[model samples]
Target: MSFNPDILDIISLTIGALLFLMVLVLIIVFALEKEYYAVRKSLILLLFPAFFLIMPFLNFPYQDYLLLGISGLISLAFIVLVMPFNNRKKISDYTFSNKVDERDIMFSRIRLEEGTENHNAYYTDRPRNKEIDDAIKANPSLLSEGSTYYNLFQFASANASFDTVEAYHDHLYKDPAPVKKDVDAKQLSGYIKAWSKKLGAVDCGITELKDYHTYSKLGRSHNYGSDCKLDHKYAIAFTVEMNKDMMAAAPAGSTVMESAFQYLNAGSIAMQLAYFLRSLGYESLAHIDGRYEVIAPIVAKDAGLGELGRMGLLMTPKLGSRVRIGVVTTNAPLNIDKATFAPDVIDFCRICKKCADCCPGKAISHSDRKNINGDIRWQIAQEECFRYWTICGTDCGRCMAVCPYSHPNNFLHNFVRKGLRNSYLFRRFALKMDDFLYVRKPAPGSPPQWVKKNS
Candidate 1:
């Protein structure tokens, strides 16, 4: 095909026009979202039109082919430069053995009635926590009228989902039927992964259950008296993507509604996984929503899913902390991915304390990671976080919404993530760029149009 000069001119103009339009759209969107950094970046991207326009004037034979080759080479060079600084490593030297006492968690303690055996025993063991506990008790409580942003309708709606999730707790722990025939481990794993995907899981991973994953005692529900002893040998952890539109309304009713909806989605997936394991003659238990016997984030970390971030949430490379986790504890033998701890993520969190800055309750820590129960981790003030939730009449997720890593799971963000994973230089550069594009403490955006209409 002969390359006509007019055709080349037309193509260049089209490209430039599309680029300009995209930049304009981005600027308007950012302005509405109140994202100053994004607005500035969009303005910069608008300059790409000049380069696109000049391409036609410097017309050479097979110009498109030459441009493609140059682009590829540049990308390759960028990757090569960034690869060395990626400090992802497996830390076999550090091992966690402390069994978490479930009674220590706020949820478990919230369910405790004053003067009850469980409550008395809990207070007897940790007298220092009693004063804080009493203070939390003094509040009107979640789903109560005294909350600052209380919406009785929304609170009730969320409670309905929680009630449904609680009903499935017993079914998850039930014993399975006998396996009459031999089963393929790999095939079963693939099946579970596919099934989970169909059930709305964005990612799935498996790991051998460690003693540190399960809590030492039963917290919440009627199982308060039971000792925390999970005999399961393996854990299946999965994540559900949070809706960006809904999450943009952080610390609001819409955000809580979205959170409740995802919890139900995760709970359904967990219940299904446990039931499937039971059908295969393997013992399994689903830890979903309010009825968790094990720490989901810890299991998720061991499963090679992601690292724990500053907000004390699982920071997956793809979705960051804007994901809901579901875990199924089982005895079903399966292949496990080696746990990887990305120093880059930890480093980024250190430099980018946006979550701490944007936290409404000041629950996130401003300090470095500490040795909590033998593992180096950031400890958030759970009492304060939950107290904020009760006051707001919602589980305020401001930290999750404003995180740079919590950008929508799309090509543009993933491209940035690829660079971030390959190079510490890129990680640092990206963080700075992110802060420039999205403010270090971006304001909470409005809910989607649909949500507003419904409300």
Candidate 2:
């Protein structure tokens, strides 16, 4: 083939046009999503066309070879960028040594009345927690009158939702009449999952119960400090979506209201599921917010719902950490789902510390994940977290609100989730984009219309 300058010029113009069009499309996409930083970055990518167009006009010696060399380098870079070489996030190889103690948790400790046997027994065993626990005990309580972000109606609404959850707390356990129904394991499992989703759950799965899933002791109501000895064969886990708009007002009363509301939604689904299973003539127990024998995140993880993220929350594919989890344990025969190990989820969490950065109490760890008991997982400082909740009169969901994974489930965000799930490079790039496109310290949004109106 002869080295014709006209042919080279045509090639250059064609390449430049395609590059320009691609950048334009990207800018439009970002703009439509109201992603200012993404639009800005895409506009900068207009430089991609500079060399292809200007190089053709440059009177360089051996221009054809120069263009070929540039093209080869660009193509190689493109391949490397898009390659799926990142390791799939594997579930931590480490497992918990034993069951967790509910009494040791902040919530359980908070409920301890001062100068009582329950209080003395706990403080005597772990004196270190005494000072801090008491400090939290003195703070303005959650949704209290004088606390930050307290609105008369908002606090009342949250309290009402919590009160409703408390009502269901005592109803978690019940005896089965008899084994009246001889059901196929797979069929029953399918029915339960479908029924859960129909009851407003976003996702549901079943996992064979594990020893580590049970708490070592009860923490709430009259059963405080009693050993939790649940030995169910299977666990049904489900998640309900927390409203994105309401969540945007995190660290405020609206977030607490949303949290409490979702707790009820998830709890209702769980209790109904458990009741249905028991009616089949098998033992079943609902694990709601206040009366949980098993760890919901661990159960959800094993049930294939989602993987645990850096904030010690279940990061579901659709809703990330923005969903509330509920579980039901039963002896009824049912199929179990295999948990997925998306190393990319871990990889993303390793880099994106938005949740940690936004935590008011500095409760979330900013360091590399550590070994807890035996499990290699991120351990959040429960005392600090709950203490902040008491002070703010809210659940202090700043971490959840700022989490990169907790974005609204729309096409633009879901596409990013897919990238985070599929490629390591994309996950790394996505975190950078998230920080750039969203913000390092995003301002909390306003409360919902209902909340505002009531206020």
Candidate 3:
């Protein structure tokens, strides 16, 4: 049998390219800090490409055409998988129909002491939550000595971070700016975004402040049940990267430490941004730590930061649910972004329930989106989740840890993300591939060396 020289060159090129990709994938897996995945990817990449290269010599009938057919098929499959076609024209499906009460949130509920006036008033209004809230409170608390995975040093460190964040509560509120400078909204918005990144934020976005973004009432610390009335016209939302190593230790002390630490980082950036805006005479309020008037995720989504996921958290394109968000609600004239339709991510969430499966608290809903607070979205079992956090002496980020989307943000993972966005078939194949390479429930990675040595 004879083949054209051009056809031969094409085959050789395809084989050589795939062989190179195989090595590239191996290096990528290693760079992503995935040992098991590196091994599995290396074998698969090597074997599959080698099969294509050695096909002509396999002594099969019409081996030359068989190789061409196989290579063509592979190319066709790649083309189909990388094509972007989805619900881009549709309106965003996750918009809230109404505002959420700050008091209704678990963090707010946890602050209320039983027998106190606020507690009685709240429990009386929502009798259904009393029993659940009480049960959660009865557990060994978060960052406490009696809880599981309670490392004294780690808890102390996490506590210290939270304490600093709380201390910044007063800093969020500033006196009128003495030097009000005339600033360009577009340039200022650009400056804010760039400066936010300089201050450790991974992403920054702006949105028109909405009634839904603000909490209905005050629920934390002093001034409980007070009206959280703020007429801020614009909001700045940003996300900060949570260390992959720390987050991989999900449902463990390291996860809590990391969460708390990132909260501080986010808070710090928010505080700085707010201060900067206010210095220019804008009425900026940094919503951080335990003092929040805005629903951070909602505000972030509105700001084009990310889409809301099944776990009821912001799933950023880069970090998935592995990042913590911070917000600065202000009267600054910053450019606002429109809500982007991310049905691909939504579709992926519908299929990928790895978070729900791994959730120690069984907090994440496995079922499809339902009418929650009048919006079509997934609702988590808040009381159940808080109870597990209390049990672990940590936030128990197993959902974030096991999430396939929460893989490290790099070329390899980003390429898979792009594929998922582009093709539903690739999304399904990627999920299966994810399971094959990393398994559904990978063991919690060991804590950082500093944590281990100290603990």
Candidate 4:
């Protein structure tokens, strides 16, 4: 059999052209997305494929063998990336026994005025936090003047969203109707899931309410120090996405504006769901911003929403931490979704410390997950994080913005995410590629043009 040099040349050209086109398209997308670093990196990468395209023109001995080897390697790499692998871990492995006390949370503690009865009493119980809390209090409050990124209009816009969410507090819980509607649990559950998507939710799920999911005590509002008596059997959890462009600005005023707006959107959805459940003759409560009896992340995770990422945020399959959670607890009989237990996400977080490295507050830990009161997980320094938030006048979403998983929910990134879940080798390769193309530490992107104009 005669070896066809012409055929080999044709094959090589096709491979080279495909590679070049793939990266070229990526460059165009990056540019459109305002990812300058990615575009720059892609330009440099084009040279590699260029060499392949010109390989036939260059006279070199063993060139045919080299091309054949390269073709084989490419095929093998693709197979390795797409192959299914078992790396899933159970949620029970990292479950925590300690139920959180909302009173101890930063939002709760910050609301306590110094020298007031509640403040004095709280510090008396946890004297160690007194100094730390006081230090954080010394900084300018969030969205206030003197703090970084304190734009009057943007902050006001954020406050308006927050105020609206606060209004929902009074309407969170309600009694069922006099006549209970005859309904199948499965049908109702399916209806709620489908309807929730139409109500601006990116994803929705259900889970039986667990003890640890509830806060030990109520913290915000007039219910301070009271035990959270939520006895709802089922929780409906859903996520509303944060605008990617706004979040790309991280600690900027635009980010907080988007955050607050999403919170309102989340709250609105939750309230509607709660009201609907009540009308169906089921007691229900909507847990939104400014009023939460249950921990949103834990509930969301149990509802099969997502795994807990290193930043101590709910890393949804599509949007990662770029989301606000809305949970509605009800006595309504409903079907529950199987909880998602993705060890691949955790494993990726272990290796990819971009969040930790990019944290301006130095609050996120670079160390491995530790056993904290029986829970094996990474815990951020809340005081340090809140302190930065107070000074910044924003939630400082640098961690979320830089997360590889937080990339736009599109075909290209979704393909990468699929590879990440399926194979460990692809995870390593993807991480390396992410670091190279996007840079290990990406700068905060410019705010949207509209936001800039307003500023």
Candidate 5:
């Protein structure tokens, strides 16, 4: 069929509109970086679209068909050239044999009361921890002014959420009646994912429970004298994204606000999942903030969710460390994804030690991953890290803010993430580029202007 002028005009208008939108997006992204030269270069690229839009109006010697063909080819080339690198390896390749002890986590230890048998047993098993444990005990606790920027109001506000989560702990561990009907694993999995998403989960995955993911002894529960044993067969893990704007204001009221917000989100999802499993005639437990039996990150990692980065937090492909995780352990039979590790994250973290450099307490490790609990991993000094938080009266999330992966979940940041995943060469290049665009030790940014007066 022969192409008509009206048809050509319509095609030109659509392409022009799309091109303009793309340019506008690029401009805004570049503006966020505060880099003038990059913005200028991106603007210069807009010339091609500007010419195309004007060319449609001009009665040049060139045929419309030829012009259309050339424009289409140019657009195709641009897409190919601009496509971000994506080097994601199979989830199986990153799996490690390492097992995690639930007793080693700070939450578990914090749940220990002085002179408790579990606390005594923990120190006996790992005597070296006593000195560090003593150090934490000596500090002005969370919500106390002994912290660096302690704000009683903010700390208490954050604590209120934790209080609500505590109210759900007992309800999670209850057993349900047996179901007469056979349970469909696939259907149940789909229902859980949908419900989790509806409850504000950013991502969800299932994995078989491993010995290392559980604590050796019960540290947090009233059964503090009992040995820790999670006999559950499967674990359901999910993540809730943290707000970039709020987190950027690290060591401030806004940072605490974001932390509490996600904790509540994650907690709610876990509680619902546990309750749902009960309705289905199964026993399950929700491990939300402050209440836990299993380590959520380890389970999430095994479930092919993401890697653990330098800040000792899950670095999901989409949200990085700027997220909170919740887990539900159950006896239900289900398909599970083998734990996957992302070496690119490790490589990037090795070079990009922004968290270590920015930490106010210098608690994050600057050295390589060490042997801890029979696993090769970087160990942050938990006592020092928590002490800093107690002093600051905030979670002291400067590390989360400075992480290159903690950028806003927008197209611009996703483009960079795609590059980091696809090519080793691009991973190295993008790490340096991230440092350039966002400083290696970015200053703690202020909250939105509107929040300042009220805050």
Candidate 6:
């Protein structure tokens, strides 16, 4: 069909105007989001639409047809990108039968004194780790003054939060009330989930306790090396978000300050949930920091909270890895939430290696997921990560800070997340756009003004 020149001009002008406005809006959005790189990139992008806007006025023959053809190609690309495809498998489709031994975790090894019997026994059992463990221990410890990014006020604040969390350890478990209170499983589950949100949890879910969820041995405290005795039938898992501004300054004092506070926040919420359950004549135990019998990320995954990311942390739908996890296991009868396996998270992680690129410790794996204990997954080098933590005197959150999924949970980002979840082609487009806007490796942000005030 022959196209009318007037109609073609109008359509071309409309497309150009829309493209210009979109780029303009993105510039403003990037500025508001504090992404200077994106703003600059958007400024450059304005030229693209500017050329199209003037295309109609040019003396060149068949210009209208060219513009129409270009618009058609763009529309076709958009449709292809938005179509959902390659949603392969649920996270549970993989098998992981092996139980983790908590005694082998970094935290457990860090607590072992050089001359103590526990240390000697552990070294005897695993002599290969002795040299590396000692080297890591030799570094200036987390929050200690002799390390990078030391700030007296920030470090003290973090320590105080950690100390307060430790205080909740004693209240993790309590005897059921003398008079049993019968409750409806579904109703109680709903109540607990709602109450958890009221107590600062970003999300909460319950799952039937599984054997792989529990640690084979106790890791920390005086009862170290003892067999784990947890026999709870249900596990309630929740997450509390970390402040994006605070965490942006990764490996800095403010980052640890925020991390510590969130740990305490999550722990306090878990303790309250456990206490409330026990009062209702249900036996429950809060799995706080340094006192966990359960593998929290696994429990959180099973509870439908989030999926595991390449950095070996739970990547929540809203907050990504920028959150602290809390768990409370109990014998209380409760309706379990079916774990909604997000193939998008896995698919995105597969293509996006930003975390690995930004990791200061080089701890995160750059390769694809491997068969880890029968389940295909990416595993970070824990020793390398912890060693860097010791050196920095902070849990260097470089990986979390740089993850595209770790962007602030707001309308602008949520819109991107929606597109990310909907289409595999959009995932590739989104990644490129993200890299163009935010850059592949963003520098660590400065701590808040208050964190630097006076000191």
lDDT of each: 0.81, 0.84, 0.84, 0.90, 0.76, 0.88
Per-residue alpha-carbon lDDT of model 1 for 50-75, expressed as tens digits? 66666767867898875556445645
Model 3 local distance difference test score: 0.84
* Cα misplacement distance, residue 192 of candidate 5 (Å): 1.0
Winner on TM-score between 1 and 5 is 1
Better of 2 and 6 by TM-score: 6
TM-score of each: 0.84, 0.88, 0.93, 0.96, 0.79, 0.95
Question: TM-score of the candidate numbered 4?
Answer: 0.96
Model 6: CA > 4 A from native: 1-5, 87-92
Name the top TM-score candidate: 4
lDDT ranking of the models: 4, 6, 3, 2, 1, 5
> How many residue pairs of model 2 clash at the backbone?
3
How much lDDT does candidate 4 score?
Answer: 0.90
Instruction: Residues 1-455, candidate 2: write the lDDT tens digits.
Output: 45456877887877778888877877887676555666887767789787787876677689889887877787786676567766753534434557888899888888888878998998899999999988998999888987888888888889899899889876777888665689999999999989899999999999999988998888875788788778889999999999877887888888988999999999999889888988899999998888888989999998998888889999999889999999999999999998867667777888888888889989999887787766788889998899888888999888888888887687767877877776777777778767776777888867777777878
Q: What is the clash count of model 1?
A: 2
* Cα-lDDT of candidate 6: 0.88
Off by over 4 Å in 1: 1-41, 44-84, 87-95
Candidate 4 lDDT tens digits, 290-317 = 8888999989999999988899999999
TM-score, candidate 3, is 0.93
Q: Which residue runs of candidate 4 sit more than 4 Å off their true CA positions?
A: 1-5, 86-92
Give the C-alpha lDDT of model 2.
0.84
Model 5: lDDT equals: 0.76
Off by over 4 Å in 2: 1-76, 88-92
Per-residue lDDT of model 6, residues 1-455, tens digit only: 55445766777778889989988888887788777778998898988688777876766877767787888998899788877765665433443478988878899999998888999999999999999998998999999999998889889999999999999877766797877698999999999999999999999999999999998888786679899888889999999999887888897888899999999999999988988988998889999888999999989999998888899999998988988999999988899999877888888998999999999999999898899878888889999999999999998888888899999888778888888889888888999999988889888888877777755
lDDT of 5 by residue, 1-455 (tens): 55345777767766777787887787788788554445666676577567667665767565587668967896775565456544444222333455445577665676677897777888898898888777776777666677665655566767787777777766766767667246888888888888899889988999988887776655556655466567889999999998877777798877887788788889888988888788878888888776677777778888778988777888899988988899999987677866656777887777788899999988999887766655677768877888687667788789998888987777888987876765666667677666655667877887656556664
